[model samples]
Target: EVVRQYKLGLARHVNEHTGRPLSRATQTYFLVALRSLLRYWAMQGLDVLAPDRVELGKAPSRSLKFLDGDQLRRLLDAPDINDLRGLRDRALMETFFSTGLRLSELARLDRDHINLRTREFGVIGKGRKPRIVFLSDAATNWLGRYLQARQDRWKPLFVRMKGKPDLAPGGPGMRMSTRSIERLVGKYVRLAGLGVKATPHTLRHSFATDLLSNGADLRAVQEMLGHANLNTTQIYTHVTNPQLRAAHRKFHSGNRE
Candidate 1:
């Protein structure tokens, strides 16, 4: 029912008239959920069942979007660290910049996940693949300050209040949800006056961009980013072109001629 209403709302929002999440993907999710509910009821012989008329919706692969360095810097510098929220926001932003973590991986980070001495942190990402990320002194020191201001024994490193991590949607003790972390990123984006569409993932793109611009190998960046495919890292390669163009313009004989 919720999915049905959501589809209707989405259609109405996208068009002048109301529509349903009549997409095959939407149907699959709704039908699968209904089947689960029906099975639970049938185990007790309640005879409940989902109607069989439902079908799946179609979906296709999509490209990702990311932010550039100047815009990124403005965004990072946007957070107000004098207050609690600002401190927390800066810490999260720093973590994203330094680690290139998926929002889920970052949200799941606990006290045990961070190690200041090694300048590293551990993240269990997609497929539960564990990867180690080295944090810069800038990131580590900022994190330390954020943790110091934080007043919680909760497992997640970033929390909302006394007992809850802002991204931890499950509750006080559980790590925050990926959705919650995304929302937090959105709020800070506006505050930073970036004037560009961005989210937490933009930090990941910036991480790769900065690395490529610094002359790090593309393969090395792929490993750091935990991408299964080399093509994913190729997008950041474009960022390096602007720098190359600048260098050529200033030093090349072609410009002199």
Candidate 2:
């Protein structure tokens, strides 16, 4: 009953999101989550109706939020590297741009996951699949700066702010949560003063977009992103420069001649 109540509650929640019904993507995700919760509870012998039976309204036709070229440049330069916190943030941003590591994959990384010498990183992506992401020269540079000032003497590549960096300090192993990663990216987005809506996942979108714009193959992008399905990678093709030009040439009044 509580699950059903929440399902009904989503209408009002969706209203707050866009003053309209939930977009198809959002509704599908909501239904999936509700169904999963119902399944878990039912397996425990609890009585509950499955959310899959609920009719999803419709999904809004909208493009994913992404950084434009100029905005991306500004975002990459947003951090103040003189301080420890800034260095860590810059490294996170750079690594995300260089290799579209999902938030969880990044959070799970320890020092061992990264090979500083070879400029490559190991990430266990979706479905526990492992893939290697190369570190760009810029990533290597910031990482070195961050590591040089490091005092944790621990494996976690990034650390939250604590009192002073003690070269040999007494502390437990700390790793940032997925939410923290989101907020950290948000901080830089604001600092960059791009005035664009963005989050950590923005970097991933930027990675895929940049690759498509540069003419990378769909299969190659799929592999780098650790996607099991090639069709999933096809979305980038839809947003490529060639497609954009074709669309304009076909529909624009100025180019229609």
Candidate 3:
């Protein structure tokens, strides 16, 4: 009874809540928690809800959100090159789009993690697995510039400000936080006036979409994105639907309309 009521309540909240509907991703988390509880009860010899009987609601197929080439150029250009902060922001944005790194992976980057000559680096992704991410020529150039302009001996790849009054005694100038990266991305996104709610994750989406659109193999994309499951990488396949439509219109002999 408790399980039934909990399931129904979750469905109602997801379907007709006052605030924003809880995303399917969020719902899956809730379901997993419930399943764990039920499994515990079953292990204790209780005749409570069966964990195996619990099913997660299907997540809707949502299209990927990404900026086009022009929009990307505009965003990269939004940060002023003359200023140190702008230089850092531009490099950060370029790296996000080029490497498709998760926020945490990017946040934890240390100065020694990247080799400018090689332009390739390894990141510890989810599940504590290490994977390689390469920087594009453009990304490399911007990052090189940012590194050259840095006067501080900060240990982090990206940091707040040098000699700032509010900077933590030994904290602020260390590693850049994930939230700070998001704010930097947001600031440039607004300045570029793309007019879409884009986050750092959107840049990651753009990286995958660009690769798939340009005929990169699915398996290669999966490896590059460091997706543990192939299904996670398959999301980019949906974003390529427009290219599929174009090909169909151009080559299909039966469809002359």
How many backbone clashes does every candidate have?
15, 2, 0
Candidate 2: global Cα-lDDT?
0.63
What is the C-alpha lDDT profile of model 2 across 12-114, one tens digit per residue? 5645433677434434445544555566677899987764565544434343445667787788788888888889988888788777678877777776567
**Candidate 3 on 1-257: residue-level lDDT in tens?**
67678777766674333355655544544565567666667788999867767786654545326667788888889998998998999899888877889888889887788887866677778766666676777778889999999876667888876455334543545677788888888888889998777888878767765654443444555566776643342223113233323432232221221
For all candidates in order, the CA lDDT equals 0.59, 0.63, 0.69
- Per-residue alpha-carbon lDDT of candidate 1 for residues 201-245, written as tens digits (9 for 90 to 100): 767866655554443444554556665433332323112234323
lDDT at position 172, candidate 3: 40
Residue 240 CA displacement from its true place in model 3, Å: 28
Pairs that collide in candidate 2 are: 23-59, 24-59
Name the lDDT value of residue 45 in candidate 2: 92
Model 3's C-alpha root-mean-square deviation from the true structure amounts to: 15.3
Candidates 2 and 3, the one with greater lDDT: 3
Winner on TM-score (2 vs 3): 3
Model 2 misplacement above 4 A: 1-64, 163-173, 230-257
Quote the positional error of residue 12 for candidate 3 in Å.
23
Cα deviation of 231, candidate 1, in Å? 13
How much lDDT does candidate 1 score? 0.59
Which run of 10 residues does model 2 get worst, by summed lDDT? 248-257
